[model samples]
Target: MKLARAIHFDESDMRVYASPARTGEWCISGGFEFSNWTEGDLTGKPRQAFANGWLGLETFGRATFVAVTALEPAELEALTDLLAEHFVTYYGAPSAEAARPVAQEEIGQMVELCEDHAPNTLLTVARELTESGVREAYRVIESSDAGLDQFAIHGSLDDEPHHH
Candidate 1:
């Protein structure tokens, strides 16, 4: 099966996200985090996350990019359990048992989304609060169409107090 994993190209995510997802962790849309948010909440780091962030399953944190990858059944089940626990602990779900199905549904949506894309393809999400509610859109960049440079900056810079 196919799924997505968080990938970081730079330290920008650390600065922009209140909680940044660890690189190489599994990820999903995670839009549920913003369900209760209002226009007034859309400022600063939270705004950056709403603009573009993938919810990392392990850390329950935000990621800027996620690349398509393979998924094993065991891993899926574990992710579901983690999410269910999160719902109970954070979202006030009655119990883990009661939250299981909803967690499965959320992960299932991501699985369905990745099913059609090739492995290693990069995915990005953009969300906005509209008159009615939140609106989400996705952008896909196939591996063949993009390279590492597009996502990250390499090399180093030295500050020798050079004068120009």
Candidate 2:
């Protein structure tokens, strides 16, 4: 696929392509590429498919992320919200619970744990930034196929995680 944009975040490297799949849809796919996790490796990623399934992505992964239900242009926002909500329900610890009273050493270990786990990093990235990322992407898409190659890297969160 011709990569239109690439987002290199804390634990994930996502590339958004100007999809040749469908007009109003996006092609979301990627995975935990254990063997080759480098600067420009697409091996471990998922095959480019339309945004019409429970996209459980993993380049080197979210388990059943990016739902295809009720999909629309607004679905991007809805997907981000649903992902956050799912995290709140299943992710064990919500981002709101991040400010727990703990020893400095414990903080260090948790940080290390996240660093060691790609899924953990993905979750953290999801918690921190998915909504804004989707919004930005939609903005570009709405601008037209001409606005296809707008790549980006998100190294920080724009706001606190949402819960419900």
- The superposed Cα distance between candidate 2 and the true structure at residue 164, in angstroms, equals 50
Steric overlap count per candidate: 0, 11
Estimate, for each residue in 19-81, the C-alpha lDDT of model 2 and write its tens digit.
Answer: 222211221332111123232332233322222111231121222222111223354443344
* Model 1, span 112-143: residue lDDT tens: 99999988888999999988788989899887
Estimate the Cα RMSD of every predicted model relative to the unseen true structure.
5.6, 17.3
**Candidate whose TM-score is highest:** 1
Task: Quote each prediction's TM-score.
Answer: 0.89, 0.20
Which run of 10 residues does model 1 get worst, by summed lDDT? 153-162
> lDDT of each prediction vs. the true structure?
0.87, 0.26
Q: Weakest 10 consecutive residues, lDDT, candidate 2?
A: 134-143
The C-alpha local distance difference test score for the whole of candidate 1 amounts to 0.87
